[model samples]
Target: MINRHLRVVLAEDSVVLRDGMVELLATRGCEVVATAGTAPALLAAVVEHRPNVAVVDIRMPPTHTDEGIRAAVEIRARTPEVGILVFSQHVETVWASRLLAGGAAGIGYLLKERVARTSEFMDALHRVAGGGTALDPEVVTQLMRGGRRGRVDTLTPREREVLELMAQGHSNRSIAALLVVSERAVEKHVAAVFTKFDLRASDADNRRVKAVLTYLAESGG
Candidate 1:
């Protein structure tokens, strides 16, 4: 008997995982409002039902490359209020960064193995539902690998702060408020950092979060 009653949409290329996830969420008191096994189906479900949260698999059918991440990006651009939780069998930091390319709030990247820990897994769901970020520890470790190469430490303290906050998925305005600065000032800092890294002009089309991650990757952060 579901008790919590959350509106959920699930997307997994694997039929077994999709069905298993639906049952798991259902048993946890969540209402599985919809399910899809492909990226297109996932996007359609998100648009059609406007589910409160989308639990997506990192690899989907067809290419099994980054379909889920692309779908999540679309969800972010189209439905800012719908939370997303990306589950992956491996730690794919590039796609993980993309999943959070919008901002870190209301998003998560968890290892598929972690789903075995029912309590922890469910907590991740609740956190995303509450507009928070839950990055898998392994994912963070993977992202930090570049730190040892001295690529990421090029950032100044302020720049580092901006990058860290950006990694957490905070908007520029929100980061500005947290740092007690004007939004324009924040923009200037972001631009300067991007310029120093030679990424701003090259990645002009990248989303704000994407720019930050690119900078971090270049820094080896």
Candidate 2:
């Protein structure tokens, strides 16, 4: 059994799935504080109830792409105390990485099919709610094969683009030219990327080289 009865807010676009999850959680000794079918509704429900944890589907209404994942990210910013378990039928590595960029504490990313059994799903949920990791084995293996455990995963999309350009031996000015941005703007992104990677050096040029090497290593080259 889990540590205690947890208050949960659930978001799943499919009415059938949402209702089924509500019932399943209730039976597992959880309090289903709120249920939502869309990303906005999920945010609102979370704000109102302040549940201990939220189970959010990666896809949701209107677009059905990554609305749920985006909302979950925002929820984390607003309420870091609320644990998040992001699930999807498909493996979206970028989204998964983004969800875990900050840290894995109180976070989960499990494939929907992996939860075919109620017991396993409940266990994963409880684990996340109590500040433990519950990543899918496939997800872990796939991410690992990229030669990136989580450090590279921590880079934002734009930052990754900038880093890639840097790794190609592009100077700040050259990177700006390639990306069609000002050199000053590129400098900010470069600094942010290096800070995220925690690279240190005696000089700026050396630091950039180290960052580029880290990127190459992460790319498995």
Candidate 3:
């Protein structure tokens, strides 16, 4: 379904990985419109090229810290149509949460190891480009564990399950399918879960999913 010949911008400090990613995307019919070795360069390229998607490293030059993620946020603010996929060597769950604080849609956070799997990497890019979230399973697991413990215990077992699935970037329809419940039932469960977590009125801009993802990422689950 990802037939669009996407124009992509890549931002990675490492030359080897950046080249590899460009080649990979080329082979998959994507156009590598631009590439940058630092956060500032990445932002400049994205702004100039106005690429359809940007594959950014969570850690980029200057500080070798969270520059890439910061650039992604700036991209989201300036160009809403430009999808962002952040790659990281470590979990950096807080960075992920911040990148998705507005909403996971049109955004992705994946561990660097995932790049070795061509199909999976492309799928993540495609999903992001199509306005869907793509979260690494490992990252989700870690976040869910934190939520499992502590005060989040007020959530029922089923609500916990729902929250976990939501953190995994599953849609209400998809969650319903996985839980073997009707969409209406899933909606009720999600509402209850949100209420239990004091997330009422937190659905501004349909950002409840973003709120959940943010909680999980910040919890380091």
Candidate 4:
């Protein structure tokens, strides 16, 4: 469940879309502390409010190219504690890779049209705000296609499936349910993936995030 007091800073160039999002979040018990229509304003709002999460659009004013993503990278560097969710109309793998280079915790990249339900969108927001990943399945698929076939090639078909699901930000139990397998089976597959990726147990780093990072890096994204 999402925290009713979840605070958010929204960034989008479209007034209609931005206002719609603000209303949507408000109805779901989230507070939109600030909203911005440009990358500079978005950065300022985040720095000032330090909201739990910031929902950003990929394209904004001026170049209408990568300003949003660039600002997102800056936000990650400046305030690692604030979560960022990229709500874009298109999937730019290179941009996604750059945004996630530092880490996957408290990061999300979701395609706007692909998000079919309100619950799904809210769940993603909650996950990112709580220091979790929320990658879209399509993003995962494209990254896998471009990924270098090194350690990833050695995995069994089932393990690859598990890894793909993991990249999509699914939990072990969720993967098990989707694959129609037992949670124990999913755990085994997850363990194998970590070992294959040379991700050792660590108190300072999340192995799951590490695995996903490896997958993204291998993708050259």
Candidate 5:
């Protein structure tokens, strides 16, 4: 099911893709409150409309560089309340690291091809808007490859599997189900991951973000 009243601010430099996405979102029961062709305009729409979430491109007008990424950074800083989902044709590990720098809550990163998968795209949006996470598996693979093999290598095969699943934005229960184990087992593995990564053990904190950061740190992002 789709969230009929979820408001969104969309930013994309290409008119064709932008319009197509807007239509897609509309059909999925989303309301596109605003659309922008550039980074600055995206910021304006986000600040003004305060949409439930924003679907942004990794590159946008003017320089055709990292405008969208920079805009997402600003959005996260100023309005942490707004969810952000960044999509791009190419994977930019550096940009993904930037978006995940502050935290993983209300954030998502997906390859442009994933957009064609209606259920996954909408589910990612809904998860981000709900202060959850939705990272693409490819993005996770990149993170894993980027991470310090010395550190990541220390984990047992099961721990590595759990870490990979975590990077894909799966919750403990979900991971347990996928692994055919109990939630308590997933919890133990997650705890081991945090300890291994030297991340402080705090159930109240966003350990998911920290775990991913460990991966990013190894990759130099």
Candidate 6:
């Protein structure tokens, strides 16, 4: 179980799924402060309740296209402190790219059918709420396959591999383990990626998150 109590604002158009989520979260020691079936209500709840995280669906009432994503973007802009998790049945890479355009810290995007285990979902929630990334592997795969080429094209094959792992929300140490290389090697590749992507060091922004955003922005379809 999560040690910290996570206050959540759940926004899903389907009542059954929403209730199920509420119960699921309750079972795991999370509190659903407010629930919303529309974008406006979700925004309002986020403002009023100031939840630790907002679990949002990609589609919602009155259009069921991109309402939830737009609201998530607004929430990031207005209150960057509150994490945003996009839980959806569809990939919707275009919308996902838009949501990450601002930043990747405290952001998560997971596909409903792909989340095979309760542990996976809960882990993602915890990661996002704690100002970390938790992107679905499939999301990263789609972005990589169709991602455009520009500055990203300048990266070496190994550097590109490192960036893809980063987009999958893997840390340098994890990437090193997965690649069977030394962590120092992984750090060097990461630094090369940062340099090639033109992500300068900054105290205000997370370079790691910015690098992932650059990868998504360039790869956005």
Candidate RMSDs in Å, in order, are 5.0, 11.2, 7.0, 8.9, 8.0, 8.4
Worst 10 residues of 6 by lDDT: 140-149
Those runs of model 1 whose alpha carbons end farther than 4 Å from true positions after fitting are: 1-4, 148-180, 187-221
lDDT of 4: 0.83
Q: Higher lDDT: candidate 1 or 3? A: 3
Clashes of each: 5, 0, 2, 1, 0, 1
> 1-221, model 5: which lDDT tens digit per residue?
44657999999999998899899898988999999999999999998999999998988879888899889988988998999998887666666666775657688888987666688889889988988777776676675444444576678899988887776556888899999999999999988988887667554435666586565344332
Best TM-score among the predictions, by candidate number: 1
Off by more than 4 A, model 2: 148-221
Winner by TM-score between candidate 4 and candidate 2: 4
Tens digits of per-residue lDDT for model 2, 93-189: 5566556554556777789877768777788888889876677766655543443345777888989998877654467898899989999999999
Write down the TM-score of every candidate: 0.73, 0.66, 0.70, 0.70, 0.69, 0.70
The TM-score, computed over Cα atoms with residue i paired to residue i, of candidate 1 is 0.73
Instruction: Output the worst ten-in-a-row residue range by lDDT, candidate 3.
Output: 143-152
Model 1 error, position 213 (Å) = 7.7
lDDT of 6 by residue, 1-221 (tens): 35589999999999999999999999999999999999999999999999999999989989999999989989988998999999998777666766675557688989999999999899989989998777886776664444334778798999989887887657888999999999999999999988886667762446675578667556651
- Candidate 4, TM-score vs. the true structure? 0.70
lDDT of 3 by residue, 132-188 (tens): 777786776554444433435677888778776776557889999999999998888
How many Å off is the CA of 11 in candidate 2?
A: 0.2
Model 6 lDDT on a 0 to 1 scale: 0.83
Off by over 4 Å in 5: 1-4, 146-195, 198-210, 213-221
Global lDDT for candidate 5?
A: 0.80
Q: Output the better candidate (3/5) by lDDT.
A: 5
Residue 86 error, candidate 5, Å:
0.4
